[model samples]
Target chain A: MTSTETHHAAGAASSTDAPAIATWLTTADHKQVGRLFIGTGLVGLLGGLVLAVLVAFERIDAEGFQLLDSGSATQVLSAARLLLTFGAVAPLVMGLAVAIVPLQLGSRSIAFPRVAASGFWMWLTGLVLSVAAIIGNGGPSGGESEMVDLYLAASVVMVLGLALAALSIAVTGLTSRAPGMGLLRAPFFSWSSFVGSIALLMSLPVFIGTSVYLYVDHRYARAAFGGNFGVNNWVGWAISQPFTYVLAIPVLGFVLDAIPVLGRTRLAQRPAANVAVGLVSVAILASLTHRAVTLPWEGDGFFSGLGTKIADLLPFGLVNVIPLLGLLGVLGLTMLTLKSAKPMLAAPLPFAVLGLLMILLGAASHLLYTVEDAALGGTIFEAGSYVAVTFGTVLLAFGGLTYWGPKLWGRRIPDKAALPLALLGFVAAALGSLPYMIAGFADQPAGVVDGFAYSGPQELWNVVTTGAFALMLLVSLAFIGLAVRSFTAGEAAGDDPWDGTTLEWATSSPPPADNFSDLIVVGSEYPLADIKNSGKVG
Target chain B: MLTLPPAPQPAPKRQVFVGTALVSAAATMLVGGMLAIWSQFRADAPFRESPRRGPIKDWMPKDIVVPEVAANMMLIAFFVVCVMAQWAVWSAKRNDRQHAGMALGMTLLMGLATLNAQLFIWSQMGVDVRGGAFNSMFYAITGVMTFLVIAGLVYTAVATFRYLGRGNSDVPTLSAHALYWYFLTAAFSAVWFVVYVQK
Candidate 1:
């Protein structure tokens, strides 16, 4: 077949060829698959954010049940965490990678495109079933036994779906790069997606393994792992501190990718930035070891001797600090890049920068939470850190969507409209997290809605956190509205609106069926820049 | 007359091999996590005095005796299975359809044999699923391993049929099939030492 025929065959189906829903249902196009993931992920984000808001509101009084009963408090908290981490963040990040990575690599299509499409549907199905199970009281510490079984089974399906998507992204990065675009030389977003995908692939299976154990032990015999109450004990690590940072691995990629382009500068210290992203994945290693090894920081003999204390603290510190250092490295590199370049005051720039700061702040808080003397292990401070990372990822997802919106859709999100949402997101993230940290420091317990004795002004902090969550809900809704309005009806974005240096910008807005009109063979990391400089195409 | 420069060649797509390697890595970690949990339980299980064997610190209950011969045979079978899987890959690369088919068939047969051995061990031991932590975990670990082996067998069958029907060697699929069996062998090795040999 001729090249044009191949491109046409690989391209997306036209509206005239099939019914719209049918075309979408069977689409192998990376862009369509990505849109499916992103659209579903946003719905999940909205659902999770609503749950978070309810949980926060329930905590406001700190003396009695308000929105939630004692019987349901823990389950709600577990469900919220599950939905936020797995349902929202994982899909959003994976969707961005699915759509954008192939374009960045100058590939005609993503590797195993059908597999990616299958992953989206499977993820959607599992997430929906998980929500149904949660509604039926099937989450961690749930009352209904059968519902618990359904939840466990659904979670496995969900995690495996994400894993399948991760596999496709990792392979695309490995085998789909344009000639001369080596791994290191690939765009930071694609590179980070690669690293992050590998990390998820390795780490998520551990969750799957644990879930299987939990399922069997819970379903047939409650002897090994505790039946319903023990669900979080085995799988909670996937949604918490070090593991949460794993979700943010691709967030760093977005910051790195967007900042350099918006600043109108080639990324300085590109290798260091790459190393920074790789370092964040170290959390995956720490997370895998989490179940097997418990840090001795809480033991009586933890402070008995200097050697013993060092032994106890070293692993804990490394696990918490390394990812923090990684985020710091990204922050430093962004600063260095922005120092000499006159950056465009674009919406994506602040979203990327502030989002990185939120994640950095969260990582820093997690390190502090590890201080044995702080006695913050079971406190709401852990929630504080979780919020920082989770919402930080949300902001980064926002940054990525705005930066790549024109490419994903055929129109750009209005800069003036999107700019304020960045600030709103920062405020929402800060308020949503810092209050929880303060409340945690004040001796308020984690995952408790009420009836805890505490001397510190926990009520005030809880009230503040409720407001923060409310603000976050508003921010999320507004951003979603803006995205929908802009994508469907906004001004048309010409190709190369950002004058992007990467290969993705060399194609038309929203790209064609084959991604590129001609296969782009690159000689440098900045292929478009090379083409423009020489006034020629490869 | 002006002529356009030759269009660049597309990069080779190795999605099958790469995707399989990723899936294999995930499977390895899944089994590794299970083994770690098993080790933890064993380390933490209390020492108990039994009538026949006094003051034993074994994680498995005193009543359960894992059939040593069958378990060992299963391990041996996996080793052979890995070898056969690799032979199929080597044969496929050379377009030797008969040898590849035979190798895949032997791999599948041995894989089924290991499954049979596992089932035999389960029957001989007669451990209840709901008996205790040890019994539950034993079934969990072994059951997951059994599932992976079943997956590997299906993979081998697909590779064999695809190779034969196409009249050409699908080396990537064959290599991926081999890699998965290798992973299964390594995973079962850990299981054997932890759940059988060490116990």
Candidate 2:
């Protein structure tokens, strides 16, 4: 066995001591389950990326495809593209969020990892069934009854998984903690992750429940969105804005986490982060309430009518902008702080910096929910922006994982040179997205398959995006290799590697199965730093 | 050899009572559903309109827009029964099994009644979006009510399964699942009789 395993063995009897498959199934050992959660989420992310690339190709050349010279219309292709927007991509992103946030909080694992695992399995099953139905020529209009039913089932599974993950995270946050990790003292990223987890747990179900009804009626009951004659579009609108929050919140966490470390100061204000989270949650609920009465809800609708007027009692959406402004101000503060702060080229810093920059672009633009061109949104710009934001968060998560992974494994990855690929991955994606922004400005239809047949800046943007994508892929592959190697074969990390703050780094590199056996008292935010300065070791 | 007294059989007969009440409520729901369907559809005048001034007609004049009276009445009654049944379940928590069972029986009877009412309403519309937003409101509200009734049935069934296996049920799971059904029923019923009825 490895030294880390020997250290783990020295601690106490282990869950791994159980028979093989049952050990995985029944173990409450948080680290094992956490690996499963992260691995599963990454795989899901990869699948989502594949779908994204295909959709972007289809949209870029909307005029048709001449590669086959088979007479394909943009209208037909766009319908398929629309399906990807709601049906495929959104759910994929959500699945990833469910897995990532819970781990960030220093919880052993989510409350019900089995349920969490089941949720993933059920979700995949639903996706396969729904995608198959669609691939076999199905939309709300074209699909048979069986196909629609299957799609509804798939949505249920995705929601179930999200709910399961959310609950697990919340429970862990509330009941499990690394001793001395008070709610107020939680790592900003973990705090944001905690708040976002709660928001998602509640909000996702309502959307999932409504979406199922929409699918049911569209296929089996009424043409809700299609038949414009007298349909109540409230559900349609509810689906849109709440979804934006689901997409935004975790990245919000990423941005929050990056600021303090990168800036070399405490957050501009702790309460500001708390308020941002609360405002966002309230905003989501109030906005949906706007839809609770009407057919289609809008960002503005939640504030306008009698029911909306009552909801306007809070003007939460407006209040929401306040925290964001405060956050932006803090981000600005961080920029100022980073100047004075020591710039270290460690695993977490460069990616943390790039990721934070990307988040600034993403979170800022999303705050303005005004309708944009579907053609524009469908363009490579939107995809590029999504990649920028996603990679930024993913990069931060990688840094956090690596920074703490050794702590969790009791082995800091030695050979720091193995880190460039991870940083490169973030840089490549950030730069890659640049071309898409330009292509979108030129009105190049994105997600299109063929290019030469069309002529313009959109085409030029598409070419650039494709070239950038190759770089991104290379970087990503390198990142995976580096990560896998470090996780398994890197240098032995001690319990306190970074002279860190927080309780997780205070105890054994990986704490016991029950987490820290005794609650450590917190005298400062960075507890381990003081310990390290004192040169305290057993 | 067996000299049990009929007057006072035993002390602490609570579990038996609660179990009986649940089983009976399930039975009531199933039976009432059958009776409502038989009475409304088995008779020849399933679609006949009532010209006479009924208490409900006076209470909600707008409800008069729908021509059929029997289905509407059954629907409203079922909505009431669902509320009563949930009340009974709530009371059972206090060891009031008989009251709980009675409440559940009421809910089941009402749930069945609502189901028949739905069938009648569906027959009237043939699923068409007519009678203005009122028609849509009427159908949507009742449709939600129907789903709740079915959900209630599932929650109780899951509870029964847990009870059989563990001796004590997963109360949180039951509460989480049951609370939604109860609220949905209460809300749908209230909307039907309170909001849409007068509108």
Candidate 3:
């Protein structure tokens, strides 16, 4: 191929030359692929939020079925959980990593760009089929066996797609660094993405293996695993506490990356930040041990032996404590960074900080949920934790979009408009989750629309939770509107709007097809800072 | 006098070997998780009274005895497969295209032999999948092994074709193919120990 043909093959040509839809379909550009993932992920978030609102509304009456029936209530809950974690949060985080990690690493393109593109399409197809199967009564507790099989099979495909994308991202981080830039010296976002992608790649397969078993047993015989009713029991670990935190792993990366830049200072304790991210990924180990190892805490032989008690408590303590320590470490590091820095009251800053706070709250709640005396398992408290992680991830993703929207679209999302949405999101996440948690203590059962009595004022809590979901739904819609409006027609963002120190800031607002027009060789962690200090560019 | 700046150096391209290693690690974990589940189920299953035998504690159905010879043969084939895969990688590194091609072909043959052996074992067992938990999990575990073998075969073939088509040895592709086979060998070893021998 000619050089120009080669360039076009590499997705260097502008979309205007060819049909836009065709260009997108065939494009191998990480930016375009990232945009596709982000767009679809937002749509997924909106759908999941709608379902969540429906679920919360159903719970409002507490004694009667409102919008969902007893038969389909659990399935809808499963669907909402499925869509929020796999469909929405994972894709959103993976999208940001795919689009920005290469740029941060100063590489011309993402590794296996075509593979990443294929991953997006495959994930989308699986997501669509999964939703369709759920609608057809094929999810965990669906009545139809075939649809349940479809959901299982489709979920495997979805997970594989995400895994493929993660492989590309992880490989890119490992192999695509610019000259003189080591892994430790790479930006916080890139480092955390590398770690998070590996975590996803490792943990997601267990889900796939479990799903395979579920599929075969459900398809062939209902003997091995509980056929339909057993679906959640087998795979629910992926969307619950600790595992749900897997989706939030990259949230810390975004928070760390955005805080220092918005504060207009270098991050304090950079290594600690990296360690915190790695510590969070350690939860993947906890997730893997979920069904494989049983914690015999509920047995009647209460205090069998000291060794037995220690062994039982060890896994629980390690599982709950490690990720919590990671979040606490992040909180401490963020505060330390802000203490000495001249901070800007930017939209992304509040979003990042508040998002981190919400995730910390979620982790703390998970630690509490593990207490045997709490009796929080199999309660809406689990839903509360899921909401905090899922919505916290949403908030972080929005912050990422706003922070990097300039680089992505050559326009800034109006900060004044976005700032309030961040606060609203925090409120929604807090209200949506905390009330459910309180009701969990009140003995509200999980995965039920009706037919349960609790002494606690479950109705009032559900009413508040419903209102919270409504607020969250509004926040999601408004954020989408802000993104669309800003990306299409907003104030022009210069090459380095935030006066950033990273390689991404060194390039044009919307980078060229090859990302950089010239080779960028880094000499320090802050390459742009080095250049500025040397007076190479003003 | 006007001076021209030096040309820019090209960026480092993607490394297939690194990608392959990551993929191999994930595949290992996938098989490891399945095997763990299999062990969990076996430990949990209660002893059943067989018509021919008094009380069998085995997870496998009493009527069907796992074809030990076939399973052992498959395990042996994988060991040979790994050696041949490494030989191919060695030849490719030395630019010995003829030897590399032969080594890869041998690896493919051995892989197919393993697959054939596994099929033989399945046919000999003839256990109904709907029989019970043991039967269901048996298929789940062995079915995944079959899929991995097929994937490894396709990978080897692509490497061989690429080496022959270009009339040159591509060390990275060959090395990655070797790593994948090694992973397969390890996975099958676990399968043999846990499912075939232990049962």
Error of 2 at A208 (Å): 2.0
Task: Flag clash pairs in model 1.
Answer: A11-A513
TM-score of chain B of 2: 0.43
Ranking by DockQ: 1, 3, 2
Off by over 4 Å in 1: A1-7, A11-16, A291-304, B1-13, B50-54
Per-candidate interface C-alpha RMSD?
Answer: 0.8, 12.0, 1.1
lDDT of 3 by residue, A47-162 (tens): 99889989889888867556777889989999988888888898889999999999899988899999999999989989999999999998988999999999999998998899
lDDT of 2 by residue, A177-280 (tens): 44566777665555655565566665554555444444544544453333211112433332233334444455455455554554445555566665655554
Q: Which ten residues in a row have the lowest lDDT in candidate 1 chain A?
A: A1-10
> Candidate 1 on A1-538: residue-level lDDT in tens?
0122223654344545688899899888999899888888888898888899899888878676577888798888888888899888988889999999999998888998888998888888888888889899888989999999999999989888898888989999999988889998899999999999999999999998999999889988898888999988888889898798888787688888888788888789999999999888888867877542235455466445778778766776577667778888989999999897789988899999888888889988887887766778788998998999899999999989999989889798999999999998899899999988988888889878888878877778887877887888888899999999999999897777788888888787778777876778889888888988887633
Report candidate 2's fraction of native contacts.
0.00
CAPRI verdict (incorrect, acceptable, medium, high) for model 1: medium
The candidate, 2 or 3, that scores higher on TM-score is 3
TM-score between candidate 1 and the true structure? 0.95
